[model samples]
Target: MTAVVRHVMVRGRVQGVGYRAWVDHEARAKNLEGWVRNLRDGSVEAVFAGAEDVVTAMITACRRGPSLARVDAVQEEAGNPDALNLRRAGERFSVLPTV
Candidate 1:
């Protein structure tokens, strides 16, 4: 199966709620390779690279986020594995600094 990548932007009540950490855990559980970070616009941004089904599942998971997060919206777009330019080759999923 070919791998696919997606760039996601999650908005609303995502900051200061351990959302990034939750995302990291979820991504790893799915064996995904990508990075997530906070944006200054009060949103959470993430990338998921893995099998198509798993990547799509990750996007669904982002819609709910952590218990503390009040997810308002989740926007996703197709992307290259290196589109974010944050993760190194062969690296596992991670939480990156805010952008």
Candidate 2:
């Protein structure tokens, strides 16, 4: 299966809403590779990589987000798999430090 990567931006009451933590949990559960962080614009951004289906599933999950998070919009863009190549080594998934 070909690998896929994406940059997802989740808007709306996303910040300080446990979205990042939920993302981390979900990413790990799905065995995805990437990171999630909070943005200054009160949005949650994440980079997920893995099999095409897995990445897309992560995107779908981002739609609902966490219980406390009210996701208004989720902007997903195709990302370069190489962008995460250096950072991920034998890692299934990880929650990046807030940026």
Candidate 3:
């Protein structure tokens, strides 16, 4: 499978609603490697790296985050794994400190 990486920003009532943790859980479950964190702008930022299809599914999932999360918009962009310091193999998904 060809691996792909993406950077996503989830907006709306994302913070203070367990969004990061939910993302961490989902990403791990999909065997994705990257990180999720909250932004001071009241949004959630995440990087997903894995099989192309799996990463796409993860982005779709971000649209309707955990029950409490009211995700308004999900913006996506091409991601550079190197920029995120992700290994091409065996990296773990994690919840990162807010940026």
Candidate 4:
């Protein structure tokens, strides 16, 4: 099955609250290939590329981030994952430094 790829921008109490870490865990667990990072605009942006069901699950999880996060919105767009190697996502899904 072709996977769904989207650029997700999450806003509201998303930073400095382990949201990025939770995303990494959730993505890996769902076997989704993507990269996540903190944006300067106080929102978290990530790319999720995976089976439709898995991608949707990840998006749902993003809606209720880690306990420290109070997610207010989740914005998704058709796009790519910001990884150096898009095909090799099984090794490690990185949690990039703040950008």
Stretches of candidate 4 above 4 Å error?
81-92
Clashing pairs in 3: none
lDDT score, candidate 4, position 82: 48
> lDDT for model 3, on a 0 to 1 scale?
0.88
Candidate 2 per-residue lDDT over residues 1-99, each given as its tens digit: 788899888999987778888988989888888877777878887889889998998899899988888889999999877657544567656555556
* CA lDDT scores, all candidates in order: 0.90, 0.82, 0.88, 0.83
Better of 1 and 4 by lDDT: 1
> Which sequence of candidate numbers ranks them by lDDT, best first?
1, 3, 4, 2
RMSD of each: 1.5, 1.9, 2.4, 2.6
- Kindly list the per-residue Cα lDDT of model 1 for residues 31-50, writing each as its tens digit: 99899999999999998998
Candidate 3 vs candidate 4: which has greater lDDT?
3
Candidate 2 clashing pairs, residues 3+ apart or interchain: none
Best by lDDT: 1
Off by over 4 Å in 2: 85-92
In the range 1-99, model 4's lDDT, one tens digit per residue, is 667787789999999899998999988888777788898999998888888888888988899999999999998878754443543445556677678
Clashes of each: 0, 0, 0, 0
TM for every model, in the order presented, reads: 0.92, 0.86, 0.91, 0.85
